[model samples]
Target: MKFGTMFTDILASFFKKNSTQLYPFEKNPTPERFRGNLYYDPAKCTGCCLCVKDCPSKAIELVTIDRAAKRFVLKYHMDRCVYCGQCALNCRFKCMGMSNKDWEHAALNKEEFLVYYGKEEDVREMLENISKPPAESEHK
Candidate 1:
């Protein structure tokens, strides 16, 4: 209301400790169970689809290239993920978890939100299949 009152308040705030964290410049430790980016381990995955089924957001999809060879690709839609950790909780093989460190997912492109977790060759194959037109894929 008064200039004197406002001046004292501003001075007090200047002397007081900062209550905000300096993110991007100064990093703070995340909690033990902090859920961030979605990660999938292809080696431990068995193509059971339990994680896929339990996800309420329908963010994860498991694609099986060869069930006999234990080859599978995990399509993780980061944008759709609710970060509820249901997929991690439902994975019996310990193939899925949320990364606390690599959680900075801010991006300008939508394609960056879609992540594929699997062997390099398998991911490439899956990407190729997705890029192909429906008519061409039907013939192959």
Candidate 2:
């Protein structure tokens, strides 16, 4: 319409008080069924490859144990994940779930996105055994 009329309207609105939410002072609560993140249960996971197979985005990877071993190695790519919940839905173990904690999944490399599932002690012991510490010196 008229340039002068629009200009005056804009100026008036600029000085007027806002009647909306004060985001800085308020924290909105998440819903009960909010799908936030993905959770993987290593104990229930049978290495069935169901999650890996059904994932449309190919974000989930089924890293099985060594040829001789009968275990699994998880490598879930959170960065590429679309949170479709398809994998979690069809999982026989019911091992997966949408996490409520929403954290920014930022990483510089693809390897950083990989997630491993296992017991705390098992993982710690595995790392310790896999990566031995420096031997004691016998200097005279």
Candidate 3:
């Protein structure tokens, strides 16, 4: 290449604006179809377990509190989810879906990734059962 041509190119490049975004301070808007954090509505759930079956990653678990009473607890394993939106798509009652607003699931402990969605009393009871010692916990 000619010296004059190379010099001109360098001059033009120096005037170009930086093409970088200030992340952490500036958050880009999530797109309309963005598959993010998984959410569940226990009130809308019908204990069908359709969402659990459709999940390819097995990230979600449906715990039946009382099938006849329509009481259930959804255990969402965030770390295992692939954000494919499959569970939401297969749900006919609109009980499960991904939320664009709450996509941030950063955590240092693996336990934080396991989220429980259900009634206050039911969730408390389930948690108590899980925390019990192996000998005290029921086998079934």
**Model 2 lDDT-worst window of ten:** 64-73
Residue 122 alpha-carbon offset, candidate 3, angstroms: 1.6
- Tens-place lDDT digits, model 1, residues 1-100: 8999999999999999989878889888888789999888898888999998998989989999987887899988999999999899888899889988
lDDT by residue (tens digit), candidate 3, 1-140: 99999999999989998677787677889998798998888988888888888888999998888878778889999999999999999999988878988897678999999999999888888889889877855665
Candidate 3 deviant stretches above 4 angstroms: 1-18, 133-140
Task: Work out how many backbone clashes candidate 2 has.
Answer: 1
Better of 1 and 3 by lDDT: 1
RMSD of each: 2.7, 7.2, 3.7
Model 1, residue 47: what's the lDDT?
Answer: 91
Tens digit of per-residue lDDT, candidate 2, span 28-120: 677767776777777777788988989998877765543244355555777778888899899988988887666456678888776656655
Model 3's C-alpha root-mean-square deviation from the true structure amounts to 3.7
Comparing 2 and 3 on TM-score, the stronger one: 3
Off by over 4 Å in 2: 1-26, 66-70, 106-111, 120-140
Instruction: Tell me how candidate 2 scores on lDDT.
Output: 0.73
C-alpha positional error of residue 44 in candidate 2 after TM-score superposition, expressed in Å = 1.1
